[model samples]
Target: MSPRDRALPDEPDESGAASGPAGARPGAHPSAGLSDLSIDLTAHEMLRRAHVLEALGPDWDPVAALRDEEAAHDLLYSGLDAEQRRMYDELVAAGVLPRRGGGHAAA
Candidate 1:
């Protein structure tokens, strides 16, 4: 589902306003839910691990940065939340991506 479709009950609707106060919201608390939008460790570590991974090299290699495809993918997806992963998997299953083909395809 799109972000619009996933709007919280506290979020503004088409009319644009939730029928509640600030403290009355569901996920309004700090310790409640999803407190980690800036929690992409693998991404944050990329620049720090650049010397080890050599990601900025003339020949950027995933094999060196990450052992194999699986490991590389693991690191890539390590940043995603459950909902994000689910959406990604669903898109993959549907044979579509956010970028649906700016290039020619066989079929």
Candidate 2:
């Protein structure tokens, strides 16, 4: 390696390749994976879950709906990365999930 290439840099490594990100160390911000708290589920899956959540809003309880709605079993709870899953739960609890579809029948 050239001298310049071998020179140790002062900057902390944030690239999550090879050696892993510096923030990946224990007690760091959870994991080395990037997260903007965006839902990472597939577009189709997200849409479906949002429809389900909204359709059953207010008077609807998400837990029971998950039980009643076959597709919801793994919709928001799974097929998502850790951060997204956390955000999904928070959105559900806060009842701010998308209300694209009008009602359970609409969903």
Candidate 3:
């Protein structure tokens, strides 16, 4: 879910007063909620997060990012030297890598 979907606590009630713990005073320290492990983001931090999200764009897909990373790793390791290929063959024979091509047919 996007960050905007997150709900902030301590929202004001219809009376415009900050609704918090029943006994909370009007000017109580903001850290009163820290004991609950809740963190209040600074304005600068929130802006930074917004900037990052904007840069990612609406079309960004986490699954696609993972696929791109895997493709990059495969390309980087695609060229195995003769000795490495021999070891890879041995490992494949021993079921270390499970099976060659990982069940995907070659292009």
Best by TM-score: 3
lDDT of each: 0.56, 0.57, 0.67
Candidate 2 is scored at a TM of 0.22
Deviation of model 1 at 58, angstroms: 18
- Model 2, range 40-72, lDDT digits (tens) per residue? 669889899899878877797767766677556
- Residue pair clashes in candidate 1: none
Candidate rank order under TM-score: 3, 1, 2
Each prediction's TM-score versus the true structure: 0.24, 0.22, 0.37
Cα lDDT tens digits, model 3, 1-107, are 36665545765443334466555666788675455556677988989989998999999999999899778757755777777767766776877754546632122
Which sections of candidate 1 miss by over 4 Å? 1-67, 97-107
Clashes of 1: 0
Measured on C-alpha atoms, candidate 3 has an lDDT of 0.67
Q: Note the residue pairs that clash in candidate 2.
A: none
TM-score of 1: 0.24
Q: What is the C-alpha lDDT profile of model 1 across 40-106, one tens digit per residue?
A: 5897687688776564777877567656755655565556767776776677667784322332221
